[model samples]
Target: MMTMPSAPQLAVQASVKRADEILVVDDTPASLQLLADLLTEAGYVVRVAPEGAMALHSALARPPELILLDVRMPGMDGYELCRRLKAAPQTCNVPVIFLSALRETTDKLRGFTLGAVDYIGKPYQAEEVLARVRTHIDLHRLKTRLAEEVEQRTEELRLSSEELEEKRAQLQALMGFMHQVREDERTSIARELHDELGQSLTALRIELSWLRKHCAPLGEVVLERADAGYALVEQTVQSLRRISEGLRPGMLDVLGLCAALEHLVSQFAERTGVSCSFSADADDYRLPENGAITVFRLVQEALTNVARHAEASQVSVRLAQEKNSLHLCVSDNGRGFASAQPRQGFGLLGMRERVLLLGGEITIDGKNGTHIDVRLPLVKGE
Candidate 1:
């Protein structure tokens, strides 16, 4: 399965990884081979599928870093095929581009809404297509590598737990260590985004701003188009800001966990109209920065799920005290998950790691209403 992480929950790690392969699915063998050769020349490992059925089968065998699909195919057309590819958890993040003859606006929108990054029409320029494909494929690969490394370390720690005298204690310590590591990673990424991507995007926006002014003497239409480009650069800057914030909420570090939760809940309520309620008996108790931020992000992701996928009416976040530990409960009045579904998601798994770092136990109840309960050790004598 493709190890794709959520965009809102984009992982923070040492260095962003890059995609290694691209899957081109076209019924026409000639076209598929052409695209494959182009990508290979551009330093990408290319995989080809002659038909939609073969594409689906190949995707299942080993998901690609990105997919270039044809919209018009005899059977299992690109749109339908892309939908199925996206529906699979293993291939959801694999960027899909409808490299087809259809050029209508609606068709483009449908492709994008299905998570395709850039739609390329048939008889395309090879360079432009290669550029975008390279960009997305690299991004996907980076995230995949980071996740794989984290999972590997996690499994190694798990193996060591078998040798410990007290497995629970050992596991708790391991969880704490992992959460701290993850938090550190997020903090590092936030710094990098703000310092590198954020600064570069802003600088690009400024350059575009200069271009608009310099081109003003040329013609009104020229100036107008320059202005339009400037706006897009600014939009990209804002997108990076949001991405940085989601990685590590500036407020969680600038503000406390309680304040962060209050902000998050209010934001959720405003956006989702879900009436999110947050309470804290944590006035005097303070979690270590790592613990506090982890819990805050945990609640943030849970509420986001409620907003995006829960179809919940109301949600509650409670932070109470247990003996020597803090008890956090996030409950929602919503359609809960089916028991048979896989118990895996980067967000939930991250939360568990955070709680584990604090020597805590996490209980998730995906029954009638979704409930995530976490118990983490508190500051002594709290």
Candidate 2:
């Protein structure tokens, strides 16, 4: 009874069959027969061609796994045939081993120049021929496999890079939307504080002043209490204004980005005693609403960071326009941290996001204290 072959037996059979195909081209019938018999006995499926033309026709018809080409053939020589074979895309990768009587260095170099993988002398041993043929075939197969793997890996890397970029863009859009929402909320709250709460506090202060003026003659304790109440109301109003401005400065919307940035620098100097100097070359320049807000917020955040972390005595903020781009730089003589260190706070990240959303670039340098440089394209009508 016949039995089915095992998995290992089947694999070995397939490998042998896959590696058996070879083409032998020679002008001499005896030499062709000898090479064919040697390869066929060693389990290779060999095809014999009398000349270079026949070899080319056979290869183009059905490309063999390997070709043993003989030089000094009639009509077209082996070198010319090898060059032609290599030039053709279909048979360019097939390994060619030259079997020739010429053992000179020039002859070998000519064969190699024509893309031959190996050269054998005229009195070639069957074992040497078989060994060389096996070596080259294995090498060709390895080279082909490596090329396939490299192509696959390159494609995979390209796809991965595309996916990563897509994800980054999505994240950026999400962050921009969140920032807008936050700003809107801040604006709403600031308006409520400035209009409603501020007015209420002002009314309360007026009523207390009237009470102090009229009811002060009633008693010293009553007058003192009235004065204290008026003072507390005044402090509340001042605190409310400060809180509202901190949340979302009305100056930013009313006075535009440049004025808002100047105000910010002035406030920072006043509050932190940092001796900040702000200079702008394009004082009349204006930006789109979003761009203005982005610039204002970036300056605000940077100044806040400087106040909180930088133990600097002086800070310089400069704004200029060159050609079609706007440039802003903030530098401080602070005890700066390592710029290469991973940023830990949301301040720098938020600033970066804001700049990126505006199609701008920002760079931070800590080599000479902390320097933040921002470049933004000055869009027309903005």
Candidate 3:
């Protein structure tokens, strides 16, 4: 049994086989033999066809690097054959040089218009023929090599683009999982504070109240001390509630996103003394739990930034649903910073990261005052 050649062996064989093939088409036997001999002596593989039909068949079956065609053949002439060769995808790139007795400019122009590369007068000199043949063959080979390089580069770019897109998707998924874990931790902490610390404080306040009311026999100073203790315990309980709410707002879970946002805006105005207004198209937007929390946190961060950075008198936040998307805009009439300078704080960066994880778009414009606009799709891809 004959063993098949290895891949490396085949590659080596291809590399060593560098001879170019030339096809000569002429009705005259002498002319065909003469050109064939000339090309064969120059270390090229030459194929001779007595007529245009045979030449076309040979070229199509196994394409050659170049063709030396006689213009005045019997049936299918040189111009017609050139047109057919150019029309065929297989032989279209093969260089064709026409041989003719006619030396008129019109004759050469006709040959060129049909896709012939060069014209050789009938009674051509051997030296001129050899020079032109070598030049055209080299040019054709260079063109083919460049085309292959372009195709290879195009394939590399396509693969690179696909890899980049895959990496981006993986990063987004990781960030989203991290956000969910963070939210779960916050909820657990909030629940612990509300149930344990809150109840204990309330019970202590009740005990102090009982002592102040029932123990009248105690001195005035002792009774006053009980009252102060009861008041302090009450204040501590209220502060605990505020802290728990900040961690995970009860309103967001119970009353939905719109109500939670409204309550938040009311508290911000009361605490900051800045005129803050909130408006929505509908009472309840009916969003998924994660989506609702994402929107609420985004707005919360925006308000915090305004209070800290924006020295604005008035702020407006609007929420609306347009078809399949949710739109939110937060604008303030504040002393905006220079647009060219980057934001020094992590607030904006965190907001951008959160939006990208959810496959949303966010734009912050600090032209007149700070303006943050966000658009999110109702349905997100995993």
User: Each model's TM-score, in the order given?
Assistant: 0.48, 0.92, 0.81
Better of 1 and 2 by TM-score: 2
Q: Which stretches of candidate 3 lie over 4 Å from their true place?
A: 1-19, 101-114, 119-125, 207-238, 335-350, 356-359, 379-382
TM for candidate 3 is 0.81
Q: Order of candidates by TM-score, top first?
A: 2, 3, 1
For model 3, residues 1-382, the per-residue Cα lDDT tens digits are: 1124457544544554343778888888878778876766566666788899999999999898899998898899999999999999999999999988888899999999989899999899988999999999999989999999999999999999999999978977887898899999989999999889888888898899999997668788888888889899988988898888889999999988889999889999998998999999988765544888888899999999989999999989899988877899999999877878848577887788788876789988888999999988776335
lDDT of 3: 0.86
Scored against the true structure, residue 94 in model 3 reaches a CA lDDT of: 95
lDDT of each: 0.79, 0.86, 0.86
Model 3: lDDT of residue 112: 94
**Candidate 1 local lDDT, residue 31:** 84
Residue 131's lDDT within candidate 3 is: 92
Q: Kindly give the stretch of ten consecutive residues in candidate 2 with the minimal lDDT sum.
A: 1-10
- Overall local distance difference test of candidate 2: 0.86
